[model samples]
Target: MSKKPTLRDVSRVTGLSMWTVSRALGDLSGVSSDTRETVRQAAAELGYVPNRVAQELRKNTRRSVAVITASTSNYYYINMMKGIQRTLRPTGRTAVVADIAAEGVYTRELEDATVQDLIQSRAAGVIATLTLSLDSVELLEKWDIPVVFVDSDPPAEAAMVPAITMDNFAASVEVGAHLAGHGYRDWLFLAYPSRWSTRADRERGIRHASERFQANLEVIESENDVESAYATLSAHLDHGSLPRAIVAANNPMVHGALRVLHERSFAVPDQVALIGYDDFDWAPLLNPALTVLDQDSEDIGVQAAQILTRIIEDQIQSERNGRPPRPAYQPADRRRVEPRLIVRRSCGC
Candidate 1:
């Protein structure tokens, strides 16, 4: 039987020094990017795979999971990441933060490239706030890795991953009812691109309650950025079709909408009411204080990490018992974190 190739073999084949080869294969810095790619390609051709789990065990290093998000600027994503880290700390695991651009914000190349990088990394599992495409999820399954989604649902075919998500529909319903109770009729819903999974669920909730209260609702789509939200609503303000309330889908939109309203002389809860989805730290400090549905992002993060950790443990146990690995597909395990509505002066409560 032929012996497996070693780092020396990769070094000899690539004509790089052993130290350089080691760093490249281990995904450490100090090697030029081109050289690392060359070494990696050569190693793949040679069928030389590193024993990632054994190396981590030998070094007594905590196994790592990649925590992925679309935008770090979102308070929701940031809080979720913090929660994931807090949950992982005591379990001898750590998180590697990775960002991806999704939903046509960039070409598929950019999103696929980021997922490729995650797959190539030595992380044992993944926890993501960004939705993974079906192809990307399949790739992860082909690699026999577990993924747990936080605040985003898995693609329809990604039946194995459990999603720790908010009950956006119910929360939106609560927000709508609360606003209706305050006698708001015309409504402006501020949101990011509808491609975002959370938006659909939230809108469904709002729609249900809007019908019940006989409220008129209109939705305006903006990019997921402060400047975009401000500019989008600024244009809306110019049309003079003022809704009695502006409901932002998330905190960043809240900031942008609030700025536009304040500058345009729309008094909160008097001329126009305001509320948003996230209960960010500054929500209560605003002049009229923003009403919000607190999603408990940290807890969602913690739950996602915990689920991923269990998947990892289950895989390890299977290997120890000489059982075939867990099946790549099972019934979807869905976990929805309920959101809470907090009424503040912003909503005229």
Candidate 2:
């Protein structure tokens, strides 16, 4: 049986010394551009996969990042992956995504395992969302990798990691303003738990809008499930009368609202108008197209990926100089992506 090819084989095939081949593959300086390309092509043709574990053992990392999300099955997350891919593809780097369980009891165990794997694999940076636990953050800090939180706001004292998420408060305010503009005086705010930063921010924004518009805002918190939302909205519908408008917090809630509205034989806009956050793909395809605040999922992914990349790059520079990386704000840092108010037939806007 033939043995697997190594750097020595690549060097022989490219006619470069093993040291030169090593530096080229590692992207270290001193190797000429032409020589580096030759070695790279030869390694690719030989189907050589660099031993990342060995590389991390030798130093902090090479040039790879990890993106951990609750699940890749959802729409918002799927779009976020697209954005991350768009940003990293040009740089010839890879974004490794670990999907923690979407549901059920094994979530904590799966999340822990995911973080441990990333650290053990010597990932240079990590982009995580709601599923990340405090213990995972502490574990990541002990490692050399820089962690980036997405859609999950950690405490301010979390210095080793910086969080990237939507300005939920402001985003909700836009929804409030839009409804208020359309004369939605009595309204209902469908909410979820404050466990996630996005939910908290969104609640804040809705509160702000409620105050500014002086609307009678009824708040209902649910577990973010179809049945929960159905029951919550159903109570409102059955008690007396539905509000003039309903602002669903996210896509799932929006879908739930639609079910209730349909069951009651009420017409959207003509009866009770509906608006939601997270403009999903099916928004326009609904019977009367959904009016929503479009959270640019791609933008979120792209910015998060770029920040993680920059942080990894800074760490590399810092290690060479025996100091922590200089604190600098990435242009993509703390980005509040604009949510466009798509006026559809549903809102009668």
Candidate 3:
């Protein structure tokens, strides 16, 4: 059997010194631009893979960042992670995905276990996608590791934490406006529990907008999973009257509601209008295309990782310069993204 290619082989193939090859592959500054590309091309051709574990050991500091999220299978996190990996490339840091079961429910045991894993893995910082418990925040604070939340706002009690979020409430208002303008005054909002900060804010926005137009809007809660949401929506349709429009607070719920609508053989827009948050490619291809609120989830991820990286660098620079300990907390930083409303056949437009 052939042995796995090593850095030595890349050096030999590229006709560069071992030190030059090492620096180039590691993205260190000492290598020239031409030499770096030459070494990378050689390594690619030779099937050479760097031993990240060995590099971490030699560096004595974790060169990896942990992304704490829920529902890794969801498309939202998938696109966000793409941005994270892209931004992290130049930093020479690796991304480790840590999935938390049931992101909406913040548990102490789960927090402890997750924190332990990050400590054991020696993660330099954390990029979180859900609400964190106070204890979880404090533990990272004590360790002096930074955390940046993505797609959700930091809990009000969480001090000095930064978050990359969307203007879900304003977007919700737009959704309500379009639905109401069409003389569809009766509205139903399907959502998961309010434990998720994102859901709560989006609900708030929709509610505010609906009230302005005197629309009769009712919010219903369902389980976070698609199947559970499907069941809940199915039962609701059986006993109660269907509204003129249904606003699903998230993508999974939207899928569930759509499935129920399909099963009931209801004509979208003509019978009952449907709209949802978080657009995906399949949205346009549905029997009657779906009107969706499209936001840049990837940009959210990139911004969160960038904030954490800046914090980590600042800390390292301070230590090397023998400066006094930097404050563990600063004013909580916040950024919001605006979403574009896509008009399609589903909204009766």
Candidate 4:
């Protein structure tokens, strides 16, 4: 087996002293531009890659932010990730997704392990899609790794943590009101479990709107995936007649409801009106099209990334100033994005 090239190999190839080669490779000011270019070319020819682990050990920081998510298959997450990556690109940092619930299930043990891994890697920061456990939050805090929540909330114990989320309660209320306008008095809400903090507010808003509009509402919970949503709704429909309208809580739930309706030969808006929480690219291309509350998930991601970046920068500055590198969150950092309803054929419009 061939041995890997080292800094010394680049020095030997460039005929430069180790100190000069180190300065050139590090992009430090002591090396002239011409010398730096020569060293870089030599290093490139030697196939020498800097050991990031060693660099991180020396710097006590990381250039990659970890996005903690559970359901990567959801379309909303795809757009959100686009926003995060786009925003982080100019900052010279990268985003890495850590799926604690890769199997479509969230467990305390998995959350703990993910946090432990991030701590071990010296992650720069975190952007979470669901509320993390108190222990995980504190552990990240202790390590000076800031967290920014996107489309989710921080645990109550960590109220000061930054979060960028939509006004889910108001958005769900709008969805309910639109259904009421369509005379959908009997409504069924297919929701993911409350592990996602948005679920409670969304349900509350739906319930409030239902009572105000004199509608009867039922809420059913499912695991955070299409298959679970499909099975949950399928089982629900086996015993009761279809409601006047169905509200799907998110992308996967929308898919599940649509699948159940199609398999049961139920015509949308003719027998069962439908609405969903998040809008996706293909929403308009569906047979009946989809009426949805569009929550600018990409913008939410951008905002979360911006907030995390700012906090990380502050921590870096604090460390340079010989202070503890705790994340400095501001009241304004807990921001909410407004959601708008996108009307389409699915809701009898």
Query: Cα lDDT of all candidates, in order?
Result: 0.77, 0.74, 0.79, 0.88
lDDT ranking from best to worst?
4, 3, 1, 2
- In model 3, the clashing pairs are none
| TM-score of every candidate | 0.79, 0.72, 0.78, 0.83
- Point out where model 3 deviates above 4 Å: 1-59, 102-108, 322-333
Model 3, residue 298: C-alpha shift (Å)? 0.9
Task: Tell me the lDDT of model 4 at 315.
Answer: 77
Worst 10 residues of 3 by lDDT: 322-331
Q: Write the per-residue lDDT of candidate 1 for residues 132-195, one digit (tens) a residue.
A: 7888877766545677887778897766577878888888888898888888888889888765
lDDT of 3: 0.79
lDDT, candidate 2, 128-167, per-residue tens: 7673667887667655566767776765666445766666
- The superposed Cα distance between candidate 1 and the true structure at residue 71, in angstroms, equals 1.1
| Candidate 2 ranges with C-alpha deviation above 4 Å | 1-64, 71-73, 104-110, 131-133, 225-228, 235-240, 316-332
Put down candidate 4 lDDT per residue, 1-349, tens digits, no spaces: 7999987798788888765775567654456789899998888888998766644442655588999998787888899999999999998999999998875789999899999898768789999999998889988886678998888889888889998888888888898889999877999999998988999999999999999999999999999999999999999999988899999999999998899999999999899999998889999999899999998898888889899989988977875774557789899999988898999999999
RMSD of each: 8.3, 10.3, 12.6, 10.0
Question: Which candidate tops TM-score?
Answer: 4
TM value for model 2? 0.72
lDDT of 2: 0.74
